[model samples]
Target chain A: MMLLQATGLVAGYGRPVVGPVDIALHRGEVLGLAGPNGAGKSTLLAALAGSVRCFAGSILRAPGVALSWQTQRQPAVAGIPLNGRELLALTGAAPAGLPPWLASRLEERLDRLSGGQLQFLHLWACLQAPAEVILLDEPTNNLDPDGVAALAAAIAQRAAAGAGILLVSHDERFVTATCQRQVLLKGAAES
Target chain B: MNVELLFDPLFLWPCLTGMVFALLLPLCGAYLRLRGEWLAALSYAQMAAAGGLGAMALGWPLALGGPAAAFLAAGVKNVFEEAAESVRGAAYAMLLLAGWGVAVLLAANLPLAERLGHALSDGQLYFTDQGHFFAALGALAVALPALAGLSRPLLLSHFYPDFYRARGRSARRLHLAFDLLVAGVLALATTGIGVMAAFALVFIPPLAAAPWAGSWRRALVLGGGLGVFAHLLAFALALVLDQPYGPVLALLLVALGAGSALLAQGHSRIAK
Candidate 1:
């Protein structure tokens, strides 16, 4: 059975402007959502992950699907401060063991972490979620070469273990290295 | 009048310690709110204030004021705080009616008992006196331990998404716990009397700060600052107005909140 499915899903923030397209993710499948800026890449990921309300159509999913959105902005919680490990753990995906560099980096605040560190840790945390399906938005925004490589390796490992991975990214290198398939949203033509 | 009571070690301890705790609670709350837990903190603060007011009213000594007037204040705060988002539009109206009701009731019932009723109405019912100030300070002290206690859960929710997700612990629980505690303390402080003024403390300062406070820390600092300013201002205003001090203070806080909002808006627009 497909671990996740979104059929004719349409959603947006203020107005209904995003999608009515169909998407499906089977276990062990990794899909890269490719699109131009404002092409609803993040919005689509939000809808699929259940963070966003679907304007139309339906999203079917396994019971415990967890989404660790690489939100374009910083993550915040009221009255408390947090670092990388705490963020991942808050999202229900703290990796058991990190390569020493990552472990040391996690000790620092997420807001202060280098972009690359933030990107790598986001993916690493998502992969650890117990959910069958995971969604990430623009997961490669701040990654350096090494960070990109680590993310790719982590996604690959998780996919091999039968978790469905969905990500939106403008980084062609990241898409090619981590994703097995790509869905390009041809703007204006479909909208 | 009661110099010994004012300096009583027990009374002074809660008052002095409470100010310290009160000051820190918002800092922690601001941090949590910045991390995206404002809802939790707000909920807790509201509940705690309501319960505290009720307790204060119930425990109120007739010698200091009396129970009837105390309950009136608690009733107002309780009603004001519980109304949800949809009914928020009605807060001003509700608050006004509460004030009017208390005014009418006092005037009708205490026609012969002028000076005593007026003093009690001012002090016990409206938080206009030094005693109320001391009590508010003490409550703040109480909140310090509560803030420290809530920190771990709040931080875990912020940094450890997995922990939050797995535990399904929304800061709502924290808010509820806080609200209940505050309400109890407020009950004790007001003896059910100074609902309107207590309500002012909870809402006005934060509302006054929200527009200009770009972050939670800024908001909390602004709120706490406003709180102190309002209390001091109310004290001065009461002395000047020669009316019951608590109502006058509540009105002043509202005015200050409005002025702050206007100033913040103008400043933001000018900067833009």
Candidate 2:
């Protein structure tokens, strides 16, 4: 089934920003979004996440389709003194109790977690959510090679488990390795 | 009828109603405070004032029944305040101040005004020494208990554990329930414009306590205690000075704000 179809999407800041582009995501598809700086990658992702208003377009999706979004910066602070399990539980993504192995492994503070571990936890939170599509904006921006590999592995696992993945990234190698297809948002068109 | 009206159950009813309103407002304030929504409490007080005024103008039927009427009036106030605060402090202040101004203008008919004033606790201006004193006392007695009960919840909701606890919980339901209860209680106690008197109970203590209170409990307790003291003292002062009680309470609140700032400075010095 077509999970999300964005037809004739014309959205941006007031003064002719970006879009007039079309995109579609189907069940179990990994679409990599590649673009340069000021290329409106983040705006596109935001529009898809429903955070940005759609100026002109029809976004059709199946009912009960949840979109999990990950930001470049950790959206929540670790200063609130909640461990991973508690945070996950609070977000309603995980059960109040987890298996011993998973519970023990995820006990690290969000700030204290290694880049790779934080990446894994972020993905884990998304994976555990009831979302059918995962939207990641620069998922591996701060990660090292190993961290990126761990992220790639996690995404692979998620895609295998029947979830659509949409991501915006600059790393060509990472995109080639993970994404089933690529869409490049080129420079703005003439008015 | 004139001599017996003094001892009539109807006469005493307004006093009892005033006392009950005094109690319910702080409960409403505490609930809003716990939600970390001070602006909400202020908004509710303004709303209550407007509704209470309107009810008084309309023959004051609600106030006749006393506490239950006061509660409904308070609920109307809370709801209006909630909507006002959702847009921020400016909207809330404008509504409250504008409403008070309109009420004053509406009470221009001296004879009708006198009757309405008597019906609604003297349009928030209890001029006599005893009337003012009871108001002050009532303000304190009502505020203290509600603060004592709801302090924990209010404080916790702002900090760590409470934040986590509120996660995924439907706090709005709890809020609506409390608002309804307050309104019901207010309805029972208030008559005519006297219902607006609840504003003194709802806001003064928390506002004064915010900057001066060292801990949450201390803030709530001190705020409630001082609110009562300032109110009573202000009312007494108003009677002695031949001033309006509403303006007296308002001025005292302003002074309390200044005094709290000074006290904060002195405390800091003593600690040093």
Please compute DockQ, using alpha carbons, for every candidate against the native two-chain complex: 0.11, 0.04
CAPRI class assigned to model 1: incorrect
Chain A vs. true chain A, TM-score per model, equals 0.82, 0.85
For candidate 2, what is the lDDT? 0.56
- Listed in order, each prediction's TM-score against the native is 0.54, 0.51
Best by TM-score: 1
Task: Please give the C-alpha DockQ score of model 1.
Answer: 0.11
TM-score, cand. 2: 0.51
Error of 1 at B250 (Å): 20
Off by over 4 Å in 2: A50-58, A70-91, A95-127, A140-154, A170-178, B1-37, B63-87, B100-272
Error of 1 at A139 (Å): 0.9
Weakest ten-residue segment in model 1 chain B by summed lDDT: B37-46
